[model samples]
Target: MTDLTEHEVLVRPRAAPEAPAGRTTGWWAMVLFISTEAATFAAILASDFYLRFSAKGSWPPTSEKEPDLVLPTTATVIILVSCLPMLLGSLAAARGSRAGGLLGTLGAFAGGVAFLVLQIVDWLSEWPDSTVSKDAYGSLFYAITGLHAAHVLIGVGMLAFLLVSLAVRRAAARPRGPVSLVAMYWYFMGVVAVAVYVTVYLSATLWATR
Candidate 1:
């Protein structure tokens, strides 16, 4: 030990790992996107109310009866129920529990598919000329509900892709971020569907039914 105190080793501390970019940015982007979409639906709803109230005598114009509430109400229940599974999946992912996430995600996806099928069947059913070209009632009805249905379909596809990525474990090792964004979108879709159901089905039935 010859002058060991004077010849001390200087160890450089290891640098901390840099966080990946777009971690919170992705969530912000989705929030903005959904804001714009909500605005669009709001405008459409306003226009519908304006047209319905402005027209003289009979909001649906006598030709078109109020839409069947049973089908759409049923679909609403299904979609709303789907949110539970989606919430479960998001929670599981946050805790890094892959098996729980997988089961919940699969359940949510199946519920979404069922909703779409039921909506399509409702659209096909003959309920006193429920086509877009039929009248103002048909046009607004299709526009609002169709827009919502499209969103639901997109959400389902996103879930499918996420489910695949999670299964492989090649990427998305920590899926909390992506799963949270998807959950946000799914919940938004459900809320919009309920609004549409109220405006298109409940209101019409109460006030415009022949």
Candidate 2:
């Protein structure tokens, strides 16, 4: 009677909306995103290795030595471990314990900050002119790692802000919003950190060999 066929509307199930399911969607999205990121870094790293190998002795230039990896590696370990608490925080948040979730996120954020500081220190120790050619390889190294570090810094700030929100009870009352997205970002930081570590360490090894 209302001419429904002329209007011709389409309806979708709310359960399968664009937002997708909660934690599971977040996990799958992180997986796909990181996979693409890994491919990009791999290309850059391989290209660097190839160039450096082309000129053996002149690769590092000998005037300068490789930066010590001990500290950065330690920081990497800390970050990797922080994943546990971040997960715990996510669970707490899902359960409506914003404060507890905040604590867990703080744990992860602390590790992220440590990684950033260590990276900055590593860069400080290596003068641009001293490292490799400082031409393509040096620039690429800085660009790749610097970009990654910037991402880490962003994640740290996000988690820290969320923590403050919890402490002040601003995130109280069932959260009108799911913290799933926030959790995704936190875990993403850790995952990317691992990828960066592997790329950097592998590059260092290849450089050592060639």
Candidate 3:
């Protein structure tokens, strides 16, 4: 005869799962920050268009010339290309590979520095005669591109800080959030850089030359 036991259970009792920590707040904060930045950039771009179309005859005036495209085009490519390494670094951090993460960040920083150097050279060569104080064209051109360049600088700084943190192994405990935020900011800056290139260089040159 089999004895029926009230305490007989096929499986052991398991502890209750821990509640997920609320992570949405950080993500929403980042989104809000980017949105505000985007709006400010939109206003600046709008002002650029308004000034461009409102000007008499050709934009850039006859005396001022369209900026040389070769260098600026190269810089745009470099800046956008850096997004790849930035992505890699973020992924590596999330995976908890300190070496891979550091290497990726360094690669991105190199690319960013190269882009900035090219920009400085291009500005010196192309805009030697053009000054922001000279006219609306110069002012808008400098304002838009300068703002974008500053964003790149900030992105690079973020990566540098991430690198330092990784070097110290501080992110081992929880690396996802900080790295993810930096990746988002980098991507936003890259997209905005493309827009700036199109507005300040491409459209302006095409319209001014026509």
Candidate 4:
């Protein structure tokens, strides 16, 4: 016969609920890397400002021959607004809706493509060297804007990878990691591009009107 007392003591308590997951350690590391990036951009911006102030003998030195920036400025507006689609894509992916996420990612990607094309068009139409002196304004303009464009290219690559991941079912099957990381990277790039657009492009373009 079973010993009732022994059996009663043998039963174990259910395990306590697991702790809620927090941001991954890798995500925190990404944040640290972004902080360093921000500092570097800030330094370049400060130097640009110093150079402009000294070269022109005034803020935005009226003498710099500003180019026709309408198309590129418009491109900047469209690109900045595309961040909404990227954010939506991230949320949709988190919810496990691959199609919805892909659509959003594609929309953002299209915007990026259009923006890049416009940048090339703008450059071809008005050689940067023609608009600003090669010594200071030209150097800073190309350096800063080129850096911004490089980041755009990187964002595009990230989006393209995400799209391929979705197409192959690898994304939904695994259903995390790559998309989330790409989204974060794209968002940071978009935000930085906006800031660069304002300081480098808008400010410089508008300076001509004054």
Maximum-TM-score candidate: 1
lDDT of 3 by residue, 1-210 (tens): 776465654454768999677766778898998999999899999999998888997887777767778888998888788889878878987787677777877877888888888878867875656778888888887888888888889888988998798779887567766777888888898789789888988887898767
lDDT scores of the candidates, listed in order? 0.84, 0.70, 0.82, 0.75
Over the stretch 1-210, how does candidate 1's per-residue lDDT look in tens digits?
554343353453557999877548888899999999999999998888899888888876678765777789889999999999889988998998776677677877988898999898888883547678887888998888899899999999988987897788742587787778888999998899888998887887777745
Clashing pairs in model 3, backbone N/Cα/C closer than 3 A:
none
Query: Tens digit of lDDT per residue, candidate 4, span 83-127?
Result: 888778878888888887888889889988988888778766757
Per-model TM against the reference = 0.88, 0.71, 0.86, 0.80
TM-score of 2: 0.71
Ranking by lDDT: 1, 3, 4, 2
Question: Which residue pairs show collisions in model 4?
Answer: none
Q: What is the lDDT of candidate 2?
A: 0.70
lDDT by residue (tens digit), candidate 2, 1-210: 665453354443245458545556545776686678667767876776677667657554464455467766787788788788888888888788877687787888888888888888878777655454556556666776787788778778877777777778787675324355567666666776676666665556556666
Q: Which stretches in model 4 have alpha-carbon errors above 4 Å?
A: 1-20, 56-64, 128-133, 174-176
- Count of clashes in candidate 4: 0
The list of candidate 3 runs beyond 4 A from truth reads 1-22
Taking every candidate in turn, the Cα RMSD to the unseen true structure, in Å, is 4.1, 6.6, 5.3, 4.5
Evaluated against the true structure, the overall lDDT of model 4 is 0.75
The parts of candidate 1 lying over 4 Å away from their true place are 1-13, 18-23
